[model samples]
Target: GRPLTFPPGYNAAQAFIDRHLDEGRGDRAAILSRHGTVSYAELAARVSRCAHALTGRGVRPGDRLLMVVQDRPAFFYLFWGAIKAGIVPVPVNTMLRSRDYAVLIEDSGCGALAYSAEFAGEIEPALAERRPALVLRLDPAEEAALFEHGPDRFDPVPAGAERDCFWLYSSGSTGRPKGAVHLQRDMAVTSELYGVRTLGATAEDRFFSAARLFFAYGLGNAMTFPLWVGGTAVLLDERPTPASTFATIARFRPTLFFGVPTLYASQLEALDQDRPDLSSLRACVSAGEALPGDLLHRWRERTGLEILDGIGSTEALHIFISNRPGRTRGGSSGTLVPGYRARILDDTGAELPPGQPGRLWIQGESIASRYWRNPERTAAAMVGGWLDTGDTYLRDEDGHFYYCGRSDDMLKVGGIWCSPFEIESALIEHPAVREAAVIGRADGDGLIKPEAWLVLTESAVGDDALEQDLRLHCKARLAPYKFPRRFHFVADLPKTATGKIQRFRLRLGAEPAG
Candidate 1:
C-alpha cells in the first residue's frame, strides 16, 4: 500500500463537502431525497447552521455526540456538523433495541444524544438507563425552527487528519458491539482507494445504497464516496424491502447501487414477478457476505448488471478486496484494491501459498486505530498496524481472493478443516433453497458435525422429500464430510443489522422455529 499523505489541519467534512463549494460546485446536487434535492452549498450551509446549534448547546471540540437518526438529510447535517465542530460523532445502528443503545451510550461516554422522534420509544428507555447531559429530539418542525436561529457562517474547527472524528460500533455477531475509533483521514483513504480507483465514480453518478448510514458500508456507499466525487446521494428513510427498493430505484434512478447479498436475492425474486426500470444503474456492489455464484449468474441474467462482490468489515472501514467494473469474477472477491495490501497466513503466522486457505491480514491507511477501550482485543487484532480481518480466505492463481467463511465459522469435520461457506454455497445451488447457513452442531457423541438452516423458495415445500432432495444435492456436490448431517427448515436465517448471517447464534442452538 502507498503511504497516506494529508496536509495540516485537514478535516473529512472539509474535504468531502466544503471543498465542493470552494471549487465552484455549490449548485451541484449533493443529496437527493423524497423531500427534495439539496445542493452542495445548501448542505454546507445546513452543516454550518447545525454546527452553530451544537456549539450553542455547549457541544465542544473532542466531545462525543451519539447520533441515532435514520437515513435522511438531517443525518447528513448532524454528522458533518459534529465533524465540522470538531466533535466526535458516533452514529449508532437505528435498528438496535433499547438495551443495545444503552450499551453504546455507556461505552462511548457520549455527552449528548441526538435522535429522531420516531425512535423515542427505544431512546427514552435507553436514556432512562443512562442519561446523557444533553438530549436533542429532532422533530421536523421543531428542528427547523431551532436551526433557523443558528448562524449561517460559522467557521469549522481546525481538526487535523489524525484527530479522532467518529466511532462506529462493530456489528456484534460474536459478542457485544465494540466501538471502532476512526480518524478524520480514514474515510478519505477508503473513498480514494475503493470509491475512486475501483468503482470509477464521477460527479455525474448518483449513488443509492440499501445499507443504512450507521454501518461502515453505508457511510462509504451513500455519503463518503458520493461526496468525494461531488456526486449525488439518494437517501431512504424506510426499511429497504424489495418493493420499496425497487420503487426507490424507479424514483431516484441512481447510477451506482449498493446492497448486500440478501437484498440482492430479494430484488431478484421481486424482479421475477415484475421487471422494473433499472436502466439508470451503471453498476452495483455487494458486501457484508460472499455472494454465491448461482445468485450472481441469476442476477446478471435478469438485470444485465453484474454485482461486484467484495469483502469488508467495520475495523477496516470498507471494502479492501472487491471486484471492479470490467474485471469481475463470478464467485471471487476481486484482487486487492489499490492502496491496500493483503496477505494470507497459516496458523503459525507464516505466509501461505496461493490456493491455500488461511487467516487474512490486511494493511491499509483506512484501518481503524483500535477497538475503543478494548486494549486486549485491539492488541490481538491489530498487529503492527496490520489488521487481522478474522476471515479465512485464499488467493487464487489469478490473484483474486475467495472467501472461505470466518475463522470461527470454519468447522473441523473428520479431521479435515471445512468451511461453512462452501457447504452453504452448495446448498443454495439447489433450486428449492433460497438461502442457507451452515454451522457446526454437536451431536450426542460430543463430536461437531455440519448442520444447516435453510430458507426455501416460495414454491418449495419443507417436507421430508424436500429435505431428502437437499441432502442428496449436497452429497452429490460436496465432499462427504462437508455434507450437513441434519437440515433445519427455516423461514429466514438470523442476520445482523447489516445483513450478515449470524452463525454464532445458530451455533449456540438459537435457531428460530420453522
Candidate 2:
C-alpha cells in the first residue's frame, strides 16, 4: 500500500502559471464561452491584476474570499487570484435567494465579497446593510485598465500541505449549509483519482461538464482536473439546458463530457428531434444520481460514447468509484479508484458480503478534514478515517459496484425492504417512459406503498395502454413487492439543478391516508 502525499511546500496552481505565464501560448485556448474565447495569456494577466487588487484591499493568507459569479473568465481569474494570494475562494450558488445568501455569507465568515455586474442587482441590496469594504466588481474594462497600470507579475505565495485551498458549500437538505473544508494537499489526491485513474485528462484533452464551479464535482472536474493536466475547459455562462449544452458541445468539440443522469435523460429527449454534432465526444461521465442502464444504453446509441457512471459526495470532495473509459460495466459504478477504498457495511459496522446492499463507507486522502464549526455533526459522519457516504451500494462478485437508492429512500412494503431505484430503473426500461421517479406513499392499509411518477415520450402519448405496459415491464423485471402500485403521469420529474430527482418533494405530495 502506498501513502498519498503532496509535493513539499506546494502551491501547484500558481506554480503552473509561473512556468507558463511568460510562454507564448496565445493560440492555446484556456476557456471558451458563448460570448468569446479567453487565451491563457489573457487569463494569466487578469489573474495577476486581480491578485494585486485583493492584496491592496488587505486580503491575506487564510482569509476566506466569497465570490458570486456565473461561469465566465472573470470567475476563473478571481478564483485563481485568491489561490495565488493564499486566500481561499468560497464560490456560492449564484441562484440562491437572499436568505440563503445571508446564511452562507455569515457561516463562511468571508472577509470580502466579489460579484459580477449581472448579479449585482440581486446581491447588492441584500448586502447593503452590512457592507464589507472589499467589494470588488468584475468589470472587464476595469481589469484591463488595472493590468495596464500595475506590474505584469506578482510573486506567488508559498503554501504547505495544511494551508486552506478552497471551501465548498454542501447542500444541507435538513439544516443550514456546512462548508466541507479542503487543504492544499487534497489536490494531489484528487488529481490522482479523477485525473489519472478515471478521466486521464492530458494537455491535449478538452473537458466539459454541466456542473458549475460552485458544485464540488464540477469544481474538481472542470477547474482542478483540467488545469492539473494542462487541459482546457469550456464554461457555460448561462444555465445548461439540454439545447444550450448540446450546442456548446457541437461548437467546442470537447473530448470529455460530464453530467448527471437527469441531464442525460434531457439530452436523450431532445436528441431524437435535433441531432447535434456530438462526434468529438470521446467519453461521457454521469453522476449526482444513479445512471439507469436503459438511459445509458439510449445515450450510447444516440451519441456513440460510453457513459462512465460514478458515485461521490461533497464530504469526499469528488468521485472515488467511477467506471473507467474502456472498461465500463453498464450498471455498475466501477471499481474504486487508486488511493481510495470503499466498503458496504451494516449499521453495526459489519461488512456486508457481495450482492448484499448496505451503507457505503469511503476512506480516502481527498476526504474533507471536517465540517466547519460543527464538531458534533462532523463526529457523527466521520469515523476514524472513513466518511459515511450516506449512499447504499452492492458489489457484485466481479467487484463492480451497483448503486442502490439512498439509505433514506428505502421503504418497507409488506414487511419487505425495497429500493426505489429498482422500481425506477425497471420503469425506464420501457420504451414509452422518458423518465421515472419512485417514492413511497402511505396507502389505505397504513403501510407505505410504492408510487411511480413518469414523463412519457412522444411515442407513448395519448395511449392509455402505455401506463399498463410500463407496469408490466416492471413486473417482469423486478420482484412483486418492488413494483410501483400507483402511477402518475407528468411532463417532467422535479429535480435539483444538479439533476438529482427530489424524492423528498415527491414524499410531500402524496395523498393523505384515511
Candidate 3:
C-alpha cells in the first residue's frame, strides 16, 4: 500500500495536465480522437486558455460547471480547465432523454452549462424549465474563438490536497443520482493503486475504453490512468457497438481496453464473423456489473486474452478489488487492491466470518468525501472513514472476494438467503441463453420463488423443449429451491446507463423495452 501524501498547493491540474510538459513529455500525444491528436504542450495551452474563458464568462472559484459534452478532446479540455481555474466540473451521461436532463439541470444549480449540438433536441427543451447563467455549445469554431483572446501563461489554482476539485454524480442504479464530492488527491490515489501498481501502465501504453467518460469507472480508465503515467488516451465519440469498438481497437491498437460485461458478451457473440486483429492488446478490464464466469472463459477462448473482472462503485471512485492479470479466478472478484480495507458485516453491524455473506464495506483514501447538499445521505453512507458499498459479498477461505448482489437485490427463497447473481450466472452458461436476470416473485401459494427473464441467442427459439432443457440445466447447477419457477423470454432487460440490470423494475412488473 502506498501512503497518501502531497506537497503544499496540490492542484489536480498541475498533476494531470502540466506535469507531463515539465517532465519532457511536451511533444507526446496526450489525447487521440476524431478531432485529431492533442499533444501535451497543446493541451496545456488550451487548458490555460479555457480557464481564462471561464473567468471571462463570469464564472468564479468554487462554482460548478455542468458538462453534457461528448467524448471528444473538448471533454478533456473542459474538465481539466475547470479544475485548473478552481471550478468544479460535473459530467453526466449524454444518452439520456430530455426529462433526465431537466432533472439534472435543476439538481446541479451550476453557474455554467456546456453541451454538444447533437443533443440540442433534448437540451433545448430542458432549458425552458431551468437555465444556468452561461451556456456554451461545444462547436469547433465556437470553442476556438471562446479562448482565443486568453493568455497562454496562466498558472494553476492554489488548491490544497483536501479541497474539493470535482464532482461525479452516481449512476442511479436504484434511485436518483447523488453528486459525489471528490478531493484534489482522490484521482491520484486510484491511478497509483489500480492503474500503475496493479495493471502496470506506462508511458508507452495506449488506453481505450468502451464505457463513456461520465462514469466513475470510465473517468479512471480513460483519463486518470493514462495521464498519471503520460500514456496516450484513445477516445471514441460514437455510440459503442460491437463493430464500432472493434474498428476503434484495430485502428488505435491500444494496449488496454476497458468494457462492461454486457459489451464483452455482445462482442464475444460477434467474434465468430467479425474478429479483428487484437495482437496489440495486453488485456481487457470489466467492472460496471459482475462478470459471469462463463463469459470470461468464452472471451478468453475466442480472443486469447483474459478479462480481469473487478468491483468498483461511484462512491469508491475506481476499482478497489480486482482480479490481477494472471491471478484471475473463475467466479471471484479477486483480492483487495493494495491500499484498500474491506469487511463483511451482518445486519447488526457486526463483522462476519470469511464464508458468511453480508454487507460489503470499504475504506480507501480515494472514496468520496460526501454527497453534495445531501447531508442525510452523506451521514448514512460515509461514516467513520468507511463507505457502505450497498453490496452483498463474502470472502472465501483463500482470501478471494465473491460478489453476491446488491444488498436489496438478494432473494429470500424458502426462508434461505440466495443470491440472484449465482442463479443468473448458471443460466448464462447454457448455450441458448445470451443474458439472464433473476428476481423474486410470489407464486400461487404466496411464497417467494426465483423468476428468470432471459434474452435468448439468435440461433435459439423459445419453446417448450428449450424450457425443459433450461430447467434441467439449472437443477443440475443450483440448489433445488433456487431453480426459477417462471421464465419470460424478453427482447431485452432494463439496465442503468452503466449497463447494470435493474431488478427493481422487474419486481414491479414493468414491461421490458423491446
Candidate 4:
C-alpha cells in the first residue's frame, strides 16, 4: 500500500489489460462469462477492435462516450477501448429510466453513446431527446460486423495520468447522480492499495462479484482488481438473485465472491432451502452498505467463509477502509487501507478523539478531484485535498472504524443524537425480521420520531401481535427514546441500483403497508 509510482504519460489500459500480454500471459483466461471464456490475447484484440470501431465512428481523444451495457465481456471491451483511445468513458446504471438517462446525456454532453440492444427501449427515448452525434448499438449482428471490419491491433493513445479516463455516476440515494471524474492513475492506486494489499488477490484467483461493472464496487471487484493481477473475472449479465449467484459459483468455481449485504442476506435465506457448493470461494466481500453483525455471524456459521465488509464511495473510486482477509473484525469497517489517511472531525473541522463519532474525512490519491459540472458541490466536498465522506464513524481503541449512519440520516430525538443503523441492527436480531430500515418520521407537532420498516421472514406473520412483539424487542435492546415509535411491515424496501436502502424515499412519505 505504499504510494504507487507511475511514469509520465500513464494509460490505465496498459496496467489493466496489456500488461498481461507483456508478461507472457496471453494464453491465460482473462474473462469468463455465459458466452464462454476469453483469454488475455483475445480480450486485448477485442479491445483494439472496439477502439478501432469507435474511432471509425468519429470518436477522438478527450471525447466523452456514455456506456449503458450490461455486465458482459462487451462492457470490458468498450470500457478499455475508450481508455485506450483516450476517450473518457462514462458508465451508467442500466436500471435507470429514460428520464434519468436524458439527464445524464445532457450533463455529460457526451459525443457518442454505446448501448446493448436489450436496452434499446430505454436508450432510444433518451437518444431522441438529446441527439448525440453518434450511437453505437451492440446488437449481436451489428457488433460482430463492426469488429470484423475493424483492425485487431491499434496503438493506444498516450493519455497522461492526469488526463480524465472515466466517470462514475453517483447512486443518487441522496439526490441526483453526479458524475465523478477520475484520472488514469486512480484505477491503479485502488487496485494496488485495496485489491493487492487488503484483499490479497493473486493471478490464480477467479473473481465473481454480484455487483455490476457500472457501479464503483463492481468495477473494482470484477474489472480492475482481477485484471491488475492477471487473474480471471466471471461476468454475469442477468439480475443477481441467490439462485443465479449460486449457480454461477457452481459453474465458474470462483475463488473470490463480492456482494452487497442485501444479496448476502438473500443467499443465506437460499442456503436454508438448498446449500450449494461454495468451497471454491476463499473470501467474500460486502460493501454498498454496512453489514450487520448478526448477518455476518450467520454467514460464517453457514458457509464457513468470512465476509469482509468495507466502506467505499463513488467519489473515492474504491474502498478506503476495509477488513483484510485474515484480520477482520466482525462488525467494524476494519482499519484504513494502506495509502490513505483518514480523520474523524467535528463540525468545526477539529479532529475528534477515538471512540467519538464524527464526520469521516479521507485523503488519498484515488479520490476523485471533482464532480463534473458542479463546482459548488465539488468545493464543498473537496476541502483542502481531503474528501468529506459525509458519513459518521468512530474509531475504537483497536484502530477499527465503526459505521454510524450518514450525517443526514442521523436523528435528533429528545435532544439526543441517534443512529438509525443502531435501531436497524437491533431490529434484525428478532427472529421474525429478515431486514429492517429505520427513518425519522415527522409527527403532528413537527418533532421527528424514529419509525421502523420491517421485511418479515416467510414464516413470520404480519399482525398487530407481531408489531407489538417487535416493538418490545427493540425496547429491550435499545434506549426507550431510540426505539422506533411506529413499525410498518413491508414486503420489500426501496433500494438504489447498488442495493442501498433508499431511506430518503421512505423519509419523503413513501409509506409501506402494515
If scored against the real structure, what TM-score would every candidate get? 0.96, 0.94, 0.97, 0.97
Candidates sorted on TM-score, descending: 3, 4, 1, 2
**Per-prediction CA RMSD (Å):** 2.2, 2.4, 2.1, 1.9
Give a tens-digit lDDT track for model 2, residues 346-465.
889899999999999999888888888999988988889899888888999988898888888888788887888888888888877878999988888788888998888776772557
The ten-residue window of minimal lDDT in model 2 covers 1-10
Worst lDDT run of 10 residues, candidate 1, spans: 505-514
Q: Of the candidates numbered 2 and 3, which has the greater TM-score value?
A: 3
lDDT of 4 by residue, 297-413 (tens): 899999999999999999999999999887778778889997899999998989999989999999999988789999998999998889999899999987899998988899989
Give candidate 1 regions above 4 Å deviation: 1-4, 510-514
Pairs of residues clashing in candidate 2? none
Worst 10 residues of 3 by lDDT: 505-514
Which of the numbered candidates is closest to the native, going by highest TM-score?
A: 3
State the TM-score for model 1: 0.96
Q: What's the CA RMSD of model 1 in angstroms?
A: 2.2
So what's the TM-score on candidate 4?
Answer: 0.97
lDDT of 1 by residue, 1-514 (tens): 2245777988788887788878999999999989899999988888888888888889888889999998988889889988999989999998879998998899999988999899999999999888988899999775795455567666778888878989999886767678999999999899889988889888899999999989999999999998889999999989998888889999999999999999898888888788789999999999999999889999989999989999889999999999989778887988999888999999999999999999999999889999999999899999998999989999998899999999989998987889999999899888888899999877777777899899989998888888788889988998887888788888988898888898988877754322
Report lDDT (Cα) of residue 45, candidate 1: 86
Question: Which ranges in model 4 have alpha carbons more than 4 Å from their true place?
Answer: 1-3, 443-446, 510-514
Off by over 4 Å in 3: 1-4, 147-149, 510-514
Candidates sorted on lDDT, descending: 3, 4, 1, 2
